[model samples]
Target: MDLRAGLSQQQSLKLSMTQELSQAIALLQYSAIELVDFLENKALENPLLHIKSRKAEVYQPKAKGQSQKSNDKAWIEQISDQRFTLADHLFPQIQDMKMSPFQKRVVTHYIYHLDDNGYFTGNLQDIANHFNFSLADAEECLAILQRVEPAGIGARTLRECLLLQLNRQEVKNELAERIVSEHFSMFAEKKWKQLSKLLSIDIKEIQQVFDYILTLNPKPGAAFHYERASYVIPDVMVVQEGDQFVVRLFDHILPKIQFNKDYFASLNSYQDKKVNDFLNEKQQDYHWIIRSLEQRQKTILNVTGKIVDKQQAYFEKGPTFLKPMTMKEISEELGIHESTVSRAVREKYVQTPFGTVELKSFFTNAIESVSDESLSSSKVKMAMEKLIKEENKQKPLSDLDIVQLLKENDGIVVSRRTVAKYRDQLGIPSSSKRKRYD
Candidate 1:
């Protein structure tokens, strides 16, 4: 053993995490919207940088019998969403009822407290205190509000909502009412055997009750809660030219960068060293930003081009034709690090012939096939969905049974656990829950 304390210089290769490099890495992962915001903030900090944003084009529908110039209208004027909201529906009903002014005021207060699900979410005690009344009086006002056209409009609970709706029916479903009132927990949890024995009814009748319950909206007021539609901006666009797909970066949707020449020239003519240093530093920052943006667009174009090439069949046909792919595979093909490819695809969407889809969705996990070839997990999921859709509902296929069916029918061998995982991913219930007596 050599026990000696000595100082020696050693040279080893290691990548430096410079601030500019970090900014580039961050800029690579930012989506179109995020990138625009980042540039706008950066412009405020650096005097040498200027950001110019390009607005997305809105469609102007062809006028039926008018000339183009005469039919031309402002884009904002053309955009309209006159949706009837829950508040609109409730206020009219409140006005039609003949009640005392104070009573109407109390009822209006109760109406304001309801959530989007039409459930009374306000505290009765708090409301009572605010109105200088008893809790019983507040509840009375709530009851009056509940008697409106929408039977379950002012219910405090799902059970109360269902029961209120049931009570409003001329031909009452007594069994449903009892189940919701008493065995709500068991019925909701799909413990039909216990529920069947407790209610003294056949499992078939319980299943019928289950089927009826599905028709009821848990969020009744959700139908009336209208919101503005959100729009998606694609980072890349793929166009089909006969049999081949061409990839183009939608970089114009992002803001354009320009050097603030007048500001730089004016500031640079100063004699102060500090002012010159600041301007020079800002100039470097602006140049680096431009370089990073170019690299970002190039990287996105390359990655999207590769994705289009790999998923040609998918673009031509649909998602059913999506092949098994991975970021590691793309990284290897592009001779770049996997993380670079991952960042490039992160939070990015590509516009295809069918529709716009998330760039990350292009890569599907591969499953080993019986013939020693890999199968796309998406394909397996699709096949699983078809099997479950066409299976006998009375004796629904178990996960193991599905695994066997996939092996026999699709020539793809997968574990029961994998099948269960895939089933869960597809939002399909377990066999026991899926099974029905009727």
Candidate 2:
């Protein structure tokens, strides 16, 4: 050990502040879909930065002898730009109408209550009471909003929404109208025989009505958004050339950024200490942006590569072959945190030979059966739905009956409450609501 003129020029290793910045970038890139939104907001706040629209050429990693061929495959691009909700679409139309500011506010409150499907979960009376408006006034506002572009925007229930649209069409089929208005539960629950008997209609006619109901849009407001507006650009590509799967990133379009040479050139011209320090600070910020972008790209590629390796069966076959996976699995595999894995897959979609699918859809939770072998919850829910479909319509299986059936037949001994949960997940109505005596 030698003590030199300086206290000892010993080399030491420590995590830099830039390492945290790298972690932040990794977190953002992993969940780019969600983080992209936050980034967009931040860009609005920061004068020096902006979020550029995703370009097609930027979708593949730059590698020697890689295919630069454009994909002819059509993808369902997410409409990311300003989407006009039911409120945005309907509020302006009501402006010229004979209504006071108080009445306008009441209508606006009801608009907020509407779900993505443009149907109000709260009752008209409740909305009116919340705003201290007359029940009649609330109903009037709701009626006007419902009449906007989306044929059924502010109805209290699914049945009311459909009937309102049907009424506007001048469709004179009384039986069809009655079925939609009164027997939607029976139809949805697949109680065909009960509906047929109750309406005194042939089973064939009831089947026709059932088919027609399926054609109606459940979420009409979603239709107003343009299909080609914006989309998710996959940070990685898994290519199957011959029998091997090679994973790489799309990096060609990402502009290789560095601290602006011109800005650095101008720095030496400034003699003032304050001006020099300010320029130096901005230079660091520029370096950070470049490094952050690089880290973001690398982390996305690494995580996506792991995902492709784990989901090989899904790539080889289709969605049915998608094994039950979780954020935990990816985190453990990559030696990262679970939250990190979650962020990486958020709003991210990958293009495959099968089709473009969201990254999150590949992961599913498993349900434990009586044999202790785990089954995908989606598979169990599907099985429950199938069982309900084949059940006797006149005596639709109750949740308790469903539990017994699962235990005896399917070897799945789930509790009645669990059965109810699965039933609800399947969008199946209860036996009491589903039953119809004729």
Candidate 3:
């Protein structure tokens, strides 16, 4: 055997994590909505950050004894001023429970350590070590807090969070409570048949319990603060200006931001090391905020531009002309990652002349039929809904019957199951539910 080695050809690209250029490229791929949010959050967390808005400029005139201009810069401030940390709420409850001061202190520390979702990310041992308390004592405090008004608060696991909530609810029977506590996994997975057999209950009864379970607040601490609210300030506003479409960001109420030049200028004269350091840090923060805002604007423009380019037909002809689209396709065309496209669409909405719509709603995967023509799942679903709406309620169509009608009458050759899925997606109640009385 020959001992000589052969070389193989390979090419690679290097990426730097710390460089702002790389970060900006990463931000570009983010949907306009995501980029704005990410930048706004960064600005809020950093004291040195500033945003320049036309609203701010108008406000300057008002400060000089003038009227408020409609085009004033809307300074994007923190959502809320009240600082309601989890520790503030939980520690008070622990104190009121008549626990020892040591236990209360331990509980306070634990609450501070919890994540936004109210889960203890750190292990119990690490928590105990941080406060010099035994693991058992730390756990006991956690247990008490878990049972508080927000039942899921301070839960270490999802199971515990759910069970705590279930305990507080008026279940009215042992069976419902047991099913929720012990068979939650089965219930969630929609293994209705299995649950019925295991619990020795009828299928309809099991389904009723399932419906009740679904109504519980999964994240009890979700509404703890205004900051945690799911808010999306649209990047692009598509309004009908006569016969054409116009696009702009909806930044009406945000504040205008600028550097405190007087403070910055004062920093130059100061000889104190700490003051200079603070000014320098603030200066860098200001730069990041300004750059992030600019990047957000550009990113939104780029995404909206692409969306308009690809979906021109839909804009002109309405939803029926919406082409098949996917995150992967958009990512490939834009030369970015799929996750970035997903993030851009996630929680981001577009205010069109027709109505306010989530950006992702414009994109739907197509299902090709035997005739070699492709139709969007959304379009198919719409067609199915139309058929159902026009169908005779006295003799409502079955899933298979709908499938045949779609193929023979509407030229959409989809399976019965596909019809069923589309029906469910459209929230078109089944034949049983749609039955009418004389």
Per-candidate TM-scores read 0.91, 0.56, 0.53
> In model 1, how large is the Cα lDDT of residue 277?
90
For residues 130-153, write the lDDT of model 2, one tens digit per residue.
778788887787776676656777
Better of 1 and 3 by TM-score: 1
Query: Considering every candidate listed, which one attains the maximal lDDT?
Result: 1
Question: Which ranges of candidate 2 are over 4 A from the true structure?
Answer: 1-232, 250-258, 369-373, 400-413, 436-438
Q: Lowest-lDDT window of 10 residues in candidate 1?
A: 68-77
Best by TM-score: 1
Give candidate 3 regions above 4 Å deviation: 1-85, 129-134, 169-172, 228-313, 324-351, 355-374, 381-410, 414-438
Per-residue error for 230 in candidate 2, Å, reads 5.8
lDDT of 1 by residue, 345-398 (tens): 999999998899999999989887888767899999999999999999989999
Candidates sorted on TM-score, descending: 1, 2, 3
Q: Write the per-residue lDDT of candidate 3 for residues 1-438, one digit (tens) a residue.
A: 978999889999897577676666566556544554665676676555555533323233335554455325434442346777666666667767867877767666667767777776668888778778788887797886676667788777777777777777764556667876788788766676788899887877876665566677677666664464655556577765677666677655454667767757767798999988888887886786578667666556556667777877777778887877887887788886777677566656787756678888878888766577677778778778888889887578888888888778767778777877878877787775564422
Q: How high is the lDDT of residue 201 in model 3?
A: 77
Task: Rank the models by lDDT, top first.
Answer: 1, 3, 2
- Clashing residue pairs found in predicted model 2: 30-343, 30-344, 31-343, 31-344, 60-250, 61-249, 61-250, 61-251
Q: In model 1, which regions exceed 4 Å deviation?
A: 1-13, 58-79, 98-103
